[model samples]
Structure formats: structure tokens, C-alpha cells
Target: MISILFAVLTALSNGTASVLQRRAAADAPEEDALRLSLLRDLLRKGIWIGGIAMSAVAAVCQAVALATGPIAIVQPIFVIELPFTLLLGGLLFHGSFPRSVWLAVAAVAGGLSLFLLAAAPSGGDASVTTGFWPEALLVTGLFLAALLAVGLRVRGNARAATLGLAAACGYALTAATMKDAMARLDHGVGAFFTGWQLYATAAIGAGSLFVLQNALQAGSLAASQPMLSIGDALISTCYGVTLFSESLRTGWWLVPQLAALALVLAGCIGLSRSPLADGLAPRPDDRPRTDVPAAV
Candidate 1:
């Protein structure tokens, strides 16, 4: 029960942190295009690093959640990050938003709530269980890693989207593996880093996450973020249902989860294309950090 709560909150925090970091990234300044090196360096130092750090924290929280729940039940719920990002965007950044955006957020949130209401909470003992898919997962992870490496090294517009999607798949893979490791553990922190599998799991998860951050920093924040967010959910959903044994409740309620997914995709689209995504540009997102009032 406590684990479930942690998983849910971790999703929320991860999402919120992304939005906040987006705002920071948007505010970063580039004084010269010709001197791309200096300008890019400055922007990375001032904003990108902070944003990336927050995302790392989110990932750690996510790992904590995976230790408690199955990937299927936990991963989709992580989609909650998108709307929470929006909420954090609005509240912290003074970002001007349309009612439709808020509606989209609400729809996704409501859908997840409905889905959780139907789904049973994960309560299995920590014993590191992998169903029938270990070989498949290993194979897929290697393919994805190769794909991402090639995508990052290559140069083309098509390659950009390809890389984004590949990296997204990689992230999903990491999350799934992390969940597996957590399940394999014995009750406490003692088991946390004791096994080779857990360490490998954490490395893959964290490494892919860094790739995700690099993707964000390397190119269009708007283009990459939405695609990544959507892809994470889809890939994770597939893994969850097949690999994690996260069964969806039958009938009537299925529509709501489906609806929620639609809402999540829609919101990601809306946010990415939004004029307000200027918050995600290289400008300071409007909101206070502590003593200073950003809007004032």
C-alpha cells in the first residue's frame, strides 16, 4: 500500500520536475548563433544542468516506486507526469494556458484515477521474479541500445525523430528492468544493491535517462519532449501487460484507461505545439524559486 502511494507520487514528481526544468531550459540565453559552442555551453551550464538534475531525482523516485509495484500498474500511472508538468508549469511559471489544456490534463488525471480504482495494488514479496520474457528483454535492450547509439551518432532530420523514439524505448526498457530487480530483492535496503542484477538494472535505467536529457539539450526541446513522453507510455504499456503481468480489469473500465491514454497523448501534443511552450524555450520560466518573486 505504501509502495503504491510512493509509485504514484513518484510519477507526479517526475512529471512536475520535467515541466519546471523545461521552463528553466526555455530561459537559457544564446547570444550568438555563429559561436554555437560558447552560447550552448552557457545555456547548458545555467539551465540544462539543473533541469537534468531534477530529472535524475525523478528517476530515483521512480526506481523506488518500481520496487513496490509491477511495471504495468506503475508505468502508465507515470503518465501522470505530463499533466503534473502542466500544473507545475502553470503554478510556478505563470504560464498562460488555454482551458482546453487544463481540460486535457484533467481528463488524463481522471482516467488514471478510474484505472487505479479497478486495478489491484501490487503486494508480492521481493523475490526478483521474471516471467517468460527475460531472453526477450535482453535481446530488445541490446537492440535498443545499438539503435540509440547509431541514432545519436548519425545526422539527419529523420534520424532525430528516430533517435527520440529509440531513446524512449530505451527508457521504457530501463523501467521494466528496474521493476524486475526490485521484485527480486528481499524486504529491505540490504537487498537494494546486493545483487548484480539490481546494479545492472540501475545502470541501464540511469544511463538511458541521461541519453534522454542529452536529446532534450541537443535539439528542439518542444519536439523531443512530447514524442518522448508519448513513446514512454506506449512502450511501457506493452512491457507492463506482457512482461510485468499487470492485468487490466475487465470490461466497462477499460474504456477509461484507453481514454486516459488518449488524453495523455492529446495533452502532449497540445503542450508541444503550444505557443506557451515558450516556457520550454531558452527563457526563464516565470515563477519564484524562493525569496525572489519571478512575476513581480
Candidate 2:
């Protein structure tokens, strides 16, 4: 119960921070991008840096949650964050969500819960060996390469989704590293290159977030967010299982996971179909334009 509550609070904080950061990014003048102001550019400093600081706090809380809770329990409850994210955009940013989006969110929530229920218990003890480094790094490299290539080839919302997927890969690999870090906390691996995994995790986690916000800032949140949620959950879950030794009880567990994946796909599709979107149109705006004759 405590762990779950902590996860909820963390997710809420995370969502709020994400929305604020996105808004700030959306409104920022490109000329002043992260520049140190001549005088006291308190607004710039606060909007950019402060939002990031709050996100850092949320990240720490999330890391703690992952360190303590079962992946199944933690990941599903974290999915509530997707709804909360859209809710934040609606309330604070004046963004409106369509009915189908709500339905998809509801479907995703239900499916994710069922997925968790069908999974094995995982909150006991986690220990990972340094021997797995080769396998972990190889898989991480593969995900990185695939996502990067996909991100480059795509445009607009699809590009954003690919970038988010890349970020997820980084984050999940970092989670695996964190597990290794936790294992080496008391060891003398600190003075030299003994705890590469720990620092690698921190670097990956932090870097991925930076990339995530940049990707979000490049396009519509509705278009980008579903991918973020689904990708993050999948990456984190796989990290738990593959690198951190988390597991499922039975083969039947795959069924719920696939069902949840379908729900996630539906949610993404619903978000894409929103009236707020420009549809398959190239431009970001949905306003009807007067058809002007081409120059002779």
C-alpha cells in the first residue's frame, strides 16, 4: 500500500512537471534557448531550470519506487499517469481531449491492471551480476540503433514517437544499471571504475529525460504521449525481467501483456484521430485556410 501510494504521488508530480516543461518549451523563444540572461531573466531561469529540477525530484522518487515495488504493480499504476498527463494538459494548458481518447485511456487502464494481476509477484530481493554486462550492453545497443534509425526516418508525430521509444530504451537500460548500482552501493567500487553500471544508469536516465522533453516539444503532446507511456512501460518491464531478473509466473502472462499492448495501440490511435490534430495534414494548425491562387 505504501509503495503504491508513493508511486501515485511520484507519477502525479512527474506528470505536472512534464506538462509545465512542455508548456515552457512550447512558449520559449528560440533566440534565448537555454542562454544565460544578460540581467536577471528569472522567468527563463525558473521556467526552464526549475521545471527540470522538479522533474529531477520526481525521477528520484520514481527510482526509489522501482527499487522497492514489483514491476507489475509499479508499471500498471504508473500507467494511470497517462490519463493524468492528458488531464493536466486539459486543465492547465487548455487542451481538450475527445471522447474516444477517454475511452482508450480507460481501456488501457483496465488492460494494464489485468496484465499486472496476471503476472508473478516480484517485490522480494533483486541482485544482478556483473557478468551480464555483455548481454545487457548488446541488447541496449540494438534498441538504440533501431530506435535512432526509426526516429531519423520519420517526421512529426511518428518521429516524436520514435524518439520517445529511444528514450525508453535508454531509461530501461539505466534501470538495469541502477539495479547493479544498488548491488554495489556498499562496495569499494566507487574510487575507481568499479561501478560503471551505477553512473551509467544515472547518465542514461537523466539524458533520456532531456531527450524526451525535446521530443515532446517538437510536436503535439497527444500525438507523442501515448508512445511515451507505452514505450516506457514496456522498456522498464523488459529491463526488470531481462537484466534485473524479474519474471512472470506462467506462459499465459504473455496474453495479458499483448492485450495491454493492443489497448496501448488503441489509445495512441485514438489520440492521433483527435479533432485537435491536423490529421494526416503536414501542418500543425487545424484552421481552415482560404485557397489563394498560385503565383503566375
Candidate 3:
């Protein structure tokens, strides 16, 4: 229960950070996309700095959650970040919530609930062996490289989605490494600082943030957010199972699990199409002048 609570807090913090960061990223010059210059530009924006602070909070909460529970359970809970982002965005930008927004929120929340109940992931090792790190890192690196290449070749929404998936992969690896590093605390603070996993987590997490910024700059939030939210949950689950030996019900339980996943996918898609989610709805200032006479 403690882990679950922390995970929920992580999701909420991440959602707020995404909204603020995306707002800042949207104003960056196109030439800065996918470059260190993007970060330099973002640093000038107070909103981006605020977002970074929220991300720091999320990171701490995530570390606590991973230490206290299986990664499979903790990571999947982040899917709620999607609804939280959209809802928060709506409130912050538009100051109104549409009916569809509420419905999409319900769908995401309900589907995630159903999936967790069906999967019931549990009983993972607190730490991974050093021997497994090489293979896991190699595979993850290659996959991220491929996605980055694809993202560079694309434009608009395609670029956003591709980079979003790459960021998701990076984040999953970060969580896995963070869990491994946190487990080292069981030894001693000295041991924790000595563990290579701690440094690796910081490096990977920084790279993920860079990719996520490029994703936000590439196109609309609707294009990137679904991939980010869903991809993270699924990829982290794989890492949990393979790296930490976490267990989930198989056999007949797979049926409900798949169904639940479908529900999540559908919900994500529906939310992505929402006007509020994409910032397509007209704000008070954006509304056209109604008092003007027809020129015809």
C-alpha cells in the first residue's frame, strides 16, 4: 500500500511536469529540436525550470516506490499520468473541463485498474545480478538507437511518436537501474554510492529527459503522449519480469490481461483524439470577434 501510494504521487508529479515542460518546449525554435541547444533554450523559461523541479520530485517518489514494491506493479501505475496530464492541461490552459475529458479519464483509470487486478504481478528480486547488466544494457541501447534514428528521419507527429517511444525505453531502463541501485542501500550508504547502477540511472534518466523534450518540440502532445504513457508501462513490465524475475499469472489469466490492455490502448487513443488533450479548443482570447459586421 505504501508503494502504491508513492507510485500514484509519482504519476501526479510526472503529469504536472509534462504539462509545464511541453508548454516551454512548444515555444522553442525548430532549429533546436533534438539538440543540446533545446535544453539551453528551455533553461531560459521559468516554466521549464518549474517542470524540472516537479520531475525531481517524481524521481524521488519513483525510487521509494521501486524500493518498496515490484517494478511490474509500480511502473504500470504511471499510465495514470496520461489522464492526469490531459486533465491538468485542460484546467491550466482552458480553465474548463469537457464531458469527453471526464470520460477519457474514467477509461484510463478503469482500464489500469482492471489490468492490475488481472495481472497481479508480485514476488520480484530486490536486486539484479551484475552478470545480467551487460546484456540488458546492450539490447536497450540498440533499441533506443534505432528509435532515435527513425525519429531523426521523420517530421511532425511521426517524429514526436518515434522519439516518445525512445524516451519511454530510456525511462524504463532508468527505472530498472534505479531499482537496482536502491537495492544497494540494503548494504550501506557507502555501497550505494559505489554501485555503478546509481550513475547509470542518472545518465539514462538525463538522456530520457532530452528525448522527451525533443518529442514535445516535434509535434502536438496528442501525438506523443499516448506512446509515452503506454510504452513506458509495457516496456517497464518487460524489464521487471526479465531483470528482476517478477511473476505475473499466466495461462487463463492472460486472457483478461490482454483484454485489459486493449482497454488501456483504446482509452489512450480516445484521450489522444480529444480537443482538450491536444489544445485544439479555442481559448477566450482565441475566439473570433462576433460583433464585427459581415464584409460581403
Candidate 4:
């Protein structure tokens, strides 16, 4: 229960952090795509600073959650962060939350709970074997490099989704490495720092921040968010199983797991189409357009 509570708190903080940062990013000066220069202007924004603070809180909650529960349990719960973002956006922007949006939120919430309960994931070793490090690094690095290449060539929504996938890869790997580092703390406080996992976590986490900023800057949240949520959940599940030796129920329970996936997919799709998703979209009156041809 403690772990579950912390996971929920983490989702809330993360969701809010995402919204705040993206809002600030929208107003920041334009820079070359995917360049470090983009963050320079945002550093001056109070909202962005608040967002970073919230992310710090989320990280603390995430560590506690991973320490107490399986990754399968903690990561899937994060899927709800999108819905939480919508809810917070409504409050912050004084916007309406439609019935369909609420329904999608309910679907996500129910599906996540059902999947976790049915899957009953368990059994993970705290410490990883040294031999696995090279293999893990090689595989994850190749995958991320490929994804990033595809993302950088695209424009608009496609670019957002692709970059978001890259970000998801970075974040999932960070979580896996962080879990291993946490496990090392059992030996002694020094053991945590002595391991390469801690260093790897920081590196990957920083990269994820850059990827996520670029994704948000490239286009609407609608385009990037679904890919971010779903990709993270999928990749994190694989990581939990392969890296930590976590197990999920098999056989007949596969039905519920599949059903849960469907529900999550549907909910994400619906939420992505919601008016709330376009909170950042320019209103017709807000910006005069010279791009569109004048009516006869």
C-alpha cells in the first residue's frame, strides 16, 4: 500500500511537472531543434523552475516506490500521468473537462488496476551480475540511437512522437539502472556510488530531459504523450523482467493483460484527441494568420 501510494504521488507530480515545463517551453525563445541552447531561455522562467522542483519530488517518490514494489507495478501506474495532466490543466487553465475525457480517464484508471491485480508480478533480485552490464548497455544504446535518428528527420506530430519514443527509451533505461543502484544500497551507502548503475542513471536521465524538451517543443502534447506513456510502460515491463528477474502471471491471465493493453490504448487515443490536449494550440483570435489565403 505504501508503494502504491508513492507511485500515485509520483504520477501526479510528474504529470504536473510536464504541463508546467511545456507551458514554459512554448514561450521560450526559438532555438535550433534539439539543441542545448533551447534550455537557456527556459532557465529564466519561474514556471519551468517550478516544474523542475516538481520533477525532483517525483524522482524521490519514484525511488521509494521502486524500493518497495516491483517495476511492473510502479511503471504501469505512471500511465495515469496523462489523465492527471488533463485534470490539472483544467484547473490551471480554467478549461472544461468533457464527459468523454472523463470516461477515458476512468478507463485508464480501471485498466491499470485490473492489469496489476491480474498480472501479480513478483520476484526480482536486487543486485545485477557484472556480466550483464555490457549487454544491457549495448542493446539499449543501439535502440536509442536508432530511434533518435528517425526522430530528428521528421517534422510536426511525427517528430514529436518519435522523439517521445526516444525519451521513453532513455527514461526506461534510467529506471532500470536506478533500480539496480537502489539494490546496491543494501550492501552499504558507498556501494550505491561505487556501482556504474548510479552514474549511468544520471547520464541517461539527463539525456531523457533533453529529448523530452525537444519532443514537447516540436508539436502538440497529443502527438508526443501517447507514445511517451505507452512506450515507457512497454519498455519498462521488458526491463523489469530481463534485468530484475520480475515475473508476471502467465497462461489464462494473458487474456486480462491483453484486455488491459487494449483499454489503455483506447484511453490514450481518446485523451490525445481531447480539447484539453490542445491547450497550447493557438486560438484563431489569438494569432492573425498571413499563411492562409484571404477569402474572395
lDDT of each: 0.60, 0.63, 0.90, 0.83
lDDT of 4 at 97: 84
Two-way TM-score contest, 1 vs 4, winner: 4
Candidate 3 per-residue lDDT over residues 1-296, each given as its tens digit: 98999999999999999999988888777889888999998998788999999999999999999999999999999999998898888777774577876777888888899889989999989999789989999999899999999999999999999999999999999999999999999999999999999999999999999999999989888888888988999999999999999999999999988888888888788788887665722345643357998455
Number of the predicted model whose lDDT against the real structure is largest:
3
Question: What's the C-alpha lDDT at position 96 in model 3?
Answer: 56
Question: Per-prediction TM-score, please?
Answer: 0.71, 0.77, 0.94, 0.93
Model 4 lDDT vs. the true structure? 0.83
Clashes of each: 11, 0, 0, 0
Candidate numbers, best TM-score first, in rank order = 3, 4, 2, 1
lDDT-superior candidate, 1 or 2:
2
1-296: candidate 2 lDDT, tens digit per residue: 66577667767876676666666555433333223331123244455566677667766776676667755456546666667776666665445667876886677677766667677547444556657778878878987888777766666677667776777677666656665566565565573246676678778876777667655655666656666666667777776776667766668777876776677567656655654333222233432245866444
Instruction: Report the lDDT of model 1 for residue 162.
Output: 54
